[model samples]
Target: MSDTAATSSRRLPPANGATLGAMFVAGAVATMAFDLWGQILSPGLGWATLSPHGLARSLLGRFGLPNGDFAGYFVHFYLVGLLGYPLGWLLVFRPAWRAVIGAGGPWILPAALYGLALWVFAIGGITAIAGLPFFLDFTGITWVALIGHVLYGIVLVAVLRRFRLG
Candidate 1:
């Protein structure tokens, strides 16, 4: 059989466990790509860096929080990022038509958490543990960080339907 015919005949997920896993991985990778690309164009595009300190101060200032220091902002920003991380999941999982994870909340939460856990673990383990700051340091703030992740989620969904990934 020709390679083209064989490729076309390959069985795809009929809305089950494996498809869900694939979707989440695709989303996470999209996010990683966004980060890398954002940093690459940050200088020329005049985009703000995703620095923790800058993010903390911007958020605090918006809410009128008492944080007049950079160090304080950095710590608080990390906590804020963790808490709001699920928002990206909410955005991505809600629009999905298939229920590979089974039930509404079960699959959604796991998918979202899976993407988040993988990202944080990858960033910490690969970047920090492996001492790869020269590359990851491009995204040290939250404003641009949100842009990257939001774009990632959007691209993830778009790609799935566009290419019939499921």
Candidate 2:
């Protein structure tokens, strides 16, 4: 193939029904893995449980919304997990990385870095928005959240790869 055609092929695939569906499923499964880590595995290992739903609830309350358990779950799971993060991965990060590196390298490192970015966004941005201290004052919960988010990223990438979508 011509160099131009090869370069174009290296670009991220356009968003379509199959791609979007795969992203959705991958995001959902990855989110579930994150929740499991936060709610079960970490606690089982004697770490503090990371309560993203509670953070979502607090943000809702700050905005004078109905900040109930269901509302929190909706915001955390539906809006952020199943929609926002996945789209950010497929639409933003993947494309930008491809543009930079020509999409020739392994995705693992990028996925891990993306997870680290997500950790910062969560611990730095989300917690602050929820009226919590930045990075929870770098407490045990902070590390726990970091691991959870990295796991989330890895799982999301793995699922996408499984579907041959990412």
Which candidate number has the best TM-score?
2
Give the Cα error of residue 83 in candidate 2, in Å: 0.5
**lDDT by residue for model 2 (1-166), tens:** 9998786655665658888888889999999999999999999999999899898999999889999999999999999898898887877787788888766788788888788899999899978987889999999999999998998888998899888866
Output the lDDT of residue 17, model 2: 89
Error of 1 at 62 (Å): 24
- Candidate 1 Cα outliers beyond 4 Å, as residue runs: 1-17, 51-92, 95-140, 163-166
Give all TM-scores, in the order shown. Answer: 0.34, 0.90
lDDT of each: 0.46, 0.87
Q: Give candidate 2's TM-score.
A: 0.90
Quote model 1's TM-score: 0.34
Model 2 CA lDDT for position 118: 93
